[model samples]
Target chain A: MRKMTKIDIITRPGKLEELKEAMYAIGVTGMTVSQVFGCGLQKGHTEVYRGQEYAINLLPKIKIEIVVCEVPVEAVLEAAKKACRTGKIGDGKIFVYPIENAIRIRTGEEGDIAIMDPEDVEK
Target chain B: MRKMTKIDIITRPGKLEELKEAMYAIGVTGMTVSQVFGCGLQKGHTEVYRGQEYAINLLPKIKIEIVVCEVPVEAVLEAAKKACRTGKIGDGKIFVYPIENAIRIRTGEEGDIAIMDPEDVEK
Candidate 1:
């Protein structure tokens, strides 16, 4: 069984394209991206709209998920941070998880093979 | 330190509301949901538009993530499976990961407290 690590990155939605490009440049292409709402240290700020104050608890964010096997986790982490950094609060966070197994529904491929590209199968 | 577990469920987008209701009934709230694209056994299908064939390799998927400490992992897992099950291909998958710690940005609350609601603080 191959040891697989899953990285879930929650960051500003604007940084998604750059992150994608950076990951692609690093030869780590497979990923699942999603739009999410969360509250961090920045939590929610009060907004005065038409003379009324409203508190927004959940903030909009983007989440990038990448499950890697052969690729170096450190490299991916660095690339992700560099791409998403804005030097401000609510920039987002990254969570690492241990994946027990992965299966490609189409091919019924399990473990790391389910995550690799067809071209990279030879590698 | 509280023992925290993160459950990531990939299921049909339509089933999200029901799953949420089920979890809420089980006293397991606080989740992050996202729209993700993936290829499972259902992968992608060929569509013919204007007599042109287009192969879609990735399918739309909804990912629901919940991090809990006091809630029994077994109960959450069962609730999720029961709500998301359709006994069909591309129904989705569930993943469990051990969480080291969680901090609520607004209150600086850490561990399980960060995950609990303010009303539940006394409990």
Candidate 2:
């Protein structure tokens, strides 16, 4: 483990199981989330009023990634800020980074206790 | 382009379109967000309280990731900060990393200019 700390999260799209149980109750594990489309202009990308070329829509979003090791990275950003809140306007965004390596692709174990668990990252 | 940066986002379940538009408006692309299950305590990991290892109800979640040139990292963060927010619970997170390289599958480009779009990544 050279030094690691990565916590990137996007929100909405139904809360992703309450922010993955609030980042696995603060202990974190392997993580990666996908499914996105957020090309700005405040959600107004498709337009062609005169001749008609409209139909861009594009907005749905969900992106989560966690690669811990930097001593829990502040408890996974305080349990993902209490599981990606909700008081208005989409509600999502947390970032922290400083990772040089993390490998466990079925057994390439490397760094920070080989990313925890798995029998202590293979004995 | 041998150096880059990475951002990862995770949150909610019902908000993809919004994220996409938001990111693009801010100028970013080629991100990944996938469905996931999170394990932890506060959410209560499945238990065999007594004689049975009860159901392991993993909380659902999503993960998103972005790798942009170092130049646009701050802008991306600012836009994301504004876009992903609610204010009560589960307020997702974001993290950035220094990338060593990024490649465009369509072309044989590697590093910075490779990830912007099909337009710049080509020879």
Runs of candidate 2 with Cα error greater than 4 angstroms are A1-3, A6-123, B39-57, B120-123
What is the Cα-based lDDT of residue B41 in candidate 2? 29
Each prediction's total of clashing residue pairs, residues at least 3 apart in sequence or on different chains, is: 4, 82
Q: In lDDT terms, how accurate is model 2?
A: 0.59
lDDT of every predicted structure (CA atoms)? 0.72, 0.59
The candidates score, on chain A by TM-score, as follows 0.83, 0.30
lDDT of 2 by residue, A17-122 (tens): 7777676655675566656754333363453333454355345667776778744677777777677776544465677766754433233344665456554443
Q: What is the DockQ of each candidate?
A: 0.14, 0.06
Q: At residue B105, what lDDT does model 2 achieve?
A: 75
Span of 10 residues, lowest total lDDT, candidate 1 chain A: A41-50
Please give, for every candidate in the order listed, the TM-score of chain B alone compared with the true chain B.
0.85, 0.74
The model with the greatest TM-score is 1
